[model samples]
Structures are given as structure tokens and as C-alpha cells.
Target: METRKKILITIGDPAGIGPEVALKAFLQFHDKAIVFVGDADVLSEAAALLKLNLAIRAVDSVSEAIFDKGILNIIDVGALRGLSWQKCVPTAIGGRASAQFIRCAVEIILNGGAEALVTAPISKEALMLGGVYYLGHTEMLAELSGATDYAMMLTGGRLRVILATIHTAIRNVPDMITLGRILGVIRHANTAAYMLGIIAPRIAVAGLNPHAGEAGMFGREEIEEIAPAIEAAALEGISVTGPHPPDTIFHKAYNGEVDIVVCMYHDQGLIPLKMIAFDRGVNMTIGLPFIRTSPDHGTAYDIAWQGRASATSMAEAIKMASTLRLPTWR
Candidate 1:
């Protein structure tokens, strides 16, 4: 029998749409070995709000989880105990509980209980309110795993983008887009391609400036910083190309001309990706010790408990975490 890979999922902020989407995903993917790590009450309330006809089973350990359909198995990290059902807001208590859920998921992966992690969206503001200071899921996971060379890759609708600089001020992006950073992101993109079953990945690098610095007319970051990085990567035997214009690089990725595109900043990559496939996008954290994927969207607080959140992205993230092969890790 082929042993199913055990995957852990953390329902991000209790007050956000994480719980709802997660439950919906479980309903669709009931046969997979999935362990939910979060507050049981929050999940139960979410289930009630969504009118989902399923049982939320709170297991003491991962081994006790029931992968059978109609049962949503959770490992209860104990958060948001007494809050009103479907009325929970972004409070410090909710934030703390969200952080605990992620921590618990990490512990499970390290303890050989799970092979991968698929986290739902967590609120940065809520995390700060709870006194847990980390930029986002990628940074938090990197710190927890002591990984120094990590990259964030977003995949959806025939497009895969790896961000060179993540969660930083726009004004500071030019300075942060160094040769080392671009090189690292290119390498990560190549690794991601390999995991996606692309043996020799054709990488497309997006320029930092308009028209690729207009051949040094608009900006020199591409001429001075990005070009050298591409040269270095090519010399290292990695198939890479461009400093292509930011506006059109994504079109190439969409048309399947390249396996992945190395982007300069967060919005530069995400705008095209979200525009292409907002609902089914999967946020993958590369260079980690274990596989970690999440929904490309954040905690949608407005339509959280109204049963309006879509589970497409969450389901795709879970599927990627379970199926993607990481040959680099071997």
C-alpha cells in the first residue's frame, strides 16, 4: 500500500476566513491524511456558520485523526475559547491563538507527524497585536526552521513567480535588489521548477525598471545588479534568461514559454498572478526543510463568517503540498 503523506493545516486568524475555507477544503478532500491545528471552538463555529454537514473531531494526537469523509479532524491547539460563534473579531486573543496554531503545525512536522504544511491566511496586524513579530508566514517559518536562504513563490493559472524581495517597503526595493538576493531567488525558482517535474527549468527574470531600465535610460538596477546575477546563475549551469520587461514577463509565463519568472518585488509578481488566478493561487515557501504552501490571499475579515469565502486557493495549496516532488531536498 502506498502510505499517504500526512499534511498539517493551520487555520490562520480565528476571526478571519481561514477556518471557513479550511473546512470547505476538508469537505472536498476528505480522503487525504490531513490534520487541522487550531482552536476547536473556532472551527466548530465556522462549520456552523457555513451550514456544512460534517463532524469536527478533536483528536489528542495526529495518529487519532480520522481521514474518513464527513469528519473534519483537528488537533486542537486551544485558542479563542469563549468568543461568540461566528462573531469573533480580530482581538489580541485571536491573534495569539493564530500564532499558536502555526507553532503547533511546525512542531508536528518536525516530530515526524506530518510531511508537509498548508497554512491559511494570517493577519499581520493581528499577529503584531498579539505580540508575535514576524513579517508573514514565510518569514516566520524560515525563522522557526533556521533557514537562511528562503524564497517565496506564487503559483496559479500557468504562472509561477518567485519574489526576490518580499514584504519590504517599495522605496527600499531598489537597494535590496542585490546580486546575491537575485541569484538566490533564481536558484530557488529553478529548484521549484524541478519540484514541479521540470528537469532543466527555463527561468525568466523580470526587470526592476520599466522596459528593462530602457537600456539604462530609466534605471540602472538591471544593468548593475540584475544582469550580473543572471550571468552568475548561468555560469553555475542553471538555465536562466532575462531582465525582461516586468509588464510582459508574466505573459510569457502565462503562455508557458517559461517554467517560472523571478520577480523583483512582491506586488510586481502578485498583481499579475492574482489577476490571472485569484481564487486558485498557491503561495509556496521554497528552501524550507519541509514543504509549506498556503493560499495566496490573506485573511479576508469582511466576509469571513458569512460563508462568502472561496476555498479554491486553499484546496490548491493542499494539493500542491501533497503532490509536488522536491528532488532538491534529496
Candidate 2:
């Protein structure tokens, strides 16, 4: 009797490694309690291609799912049978199916059937081509769950980084780095820390400009916005620090000086995590009403369906999701 709420998984783009990795990871942690929100045919196809003979079954709910030694339960989200999808290539049909899977999973979790969500990798280009117009999973979940203030966080090994701005162009980043947004992300970072059961979390904020703007030499964003946000969060009794040089803040986090690093942009944080823990990193969305986690890797179109895609990240995402419950996004 595993009373812990089941983890809902959405196999990402049908044309990518999402299905293969998801099915592979599901086998690794099937006892953790999970229900796949995806196309059963796609899952079977991936299993066949990977030479896995695990029994895959479709159900309407967790209660209807028949979990056994060689069987995996899935709640099929799309009727994608007979569709010709190319492996390793983004297609509108695949994107549509992936989006449907995500939406169905969100609906199930929000309805109290599950406690957390683990999604496979998806391509933004394919998502748009399929007429599902959110930038990524973070955006899609935020809008679907009606969460306005949310931040994307990626954690692996000892490193956890939260993004202040995500899925935007470099030139547009400066404008998006307002004091309000930074403060929100910092608060969200704090929320993320609590979700992971960390108390009095040490918060490290990375500077936007080089050398932390060198005190307004390279850029004034640190002086005008980032620093102020940190100060404000601190005044509210949060153990917050920096606008530290981006080059060095991650090093400090990795060494355990800080519990989490509040990165100003996407690459500033991900580059370090992926460089080191790409195989097992977990991407989490903070400030959402329900727990949401995803593998930090993307649809590896280059190696899709070749059975070379690693399931380590996917397994890690499911394990993390199963452990963390929904927390207040304050």
C-alpha cells in the first residue's frame, strides 16, 4: 500500500528520445508508482525498438492501472495511431501529441489524482509547429495551472540554480530583469529550497554583467536592479546574498557555500549544471501549485530512437518528483 500519491509522467515529443528515455526510466523505477500520460503506441514502439519486452497497458486512471512485474500502466492522451512520424526530427504531429500529453497530465494532477509530474524532453520549435504556442514545459504548466509567478530551476548532484529569465533572447534579457522579477525568482528559490526540505537556505544571486558589473563599469543592471532585489529579499528575513560575479557564484554553490544559486539568465545557470550533471540533472518549476519536474535534457534529435539516449536524467526526475509534494508557492 504505497500511500504516497502517484507520479504522473508525460512522454515528451513523439519524434524524439522522450518516449525511449521515458519508457526506459519507467522500468528502472516502476515501483515508485507512476502513470504515463502519453500515446501507448508510441511507448510500445519505443520499447520494441529498444528491444524491451515489458508489458505496457493503458488505463483511464491510476486505480484502473494494472501494475505487475512486467507491466507498465499508461493513460493514453492522444490517438496518434497510424501517424507517420520521423525519428530525430521535430514534426507538427509530434508536437501536438506531446502538448496533449502535457495537458492531460496537468489535468490529472490538478484534480488530486497525483502529487507530482515528470515530463520528458520536448522541442520548442516542434511545439510551435504543432500549434501549441507556449515556449516550453515551464510556460505551458504555468499557464495551464494558472500560476503567474513561477521560476524554472535545475538541480543535480550538489548544485541547484533558479533562472530569473527563461526562454528569451539575449538582447531581450536586460529588459526582463526588472527588480520585481528578480525578487519573485528569489522568493521562488526560497520556496524551492523548502520543497527540498532545506531550512534557512543560503541564497546566492548571480550578477548580470561581467565582474558583477564592476560596480557599474560593465553594466548598471547589478547596481540598479539585481542588488536591490537581493537587499529587499534580505530585509524580509531571507538569508540572501549577492549579485556575485556569474563566473564564480556557481563555483560557490557547487562547493556548498550556498544552498542555491539564483542565476540571472538561462545559460548562466544551465551551462554549469549540464556540463557536470547532464546525465542526472532534474529541472523543477517553482511557484507552481503542484510539483513539476522534468529531465534537464532536451529532445536529443541527433540520437533519437537509436537506443543511445540515456535514461539517467529521466529516472532522476521521477525520483525527485516522487519525493517532493506540492508546496505553497509564496
Best by TM-score: 2
Runs of candidate 1 exceeding 4 Å displacement: 82-88, 328-330
Distance from true position, residue 235, model 2, in Å?
1.6
* Cα lDDT tens digits for candidate 1, 207-300: 9999999999999999999999999999999999999999888888888898899999999999988998999999999998889999999888
Task: Tell me model 2's lDDT, rounded to 2 decimals.
Answer: 0.89
Go through the candidates in order and give the clash count of each: 0, 0
* TM-scores for every candidate against the unseen true structure: 0.95, 0.96
The CA lDDT of each predicted structure is: 0.88, 0.89
Model 2, 184: alpha-carbon shift in Å? 0.6
In model 1, pairs of residues that clash are none
Q: What's the distance in Å from true for residue 245, model 2?
A: 1.1
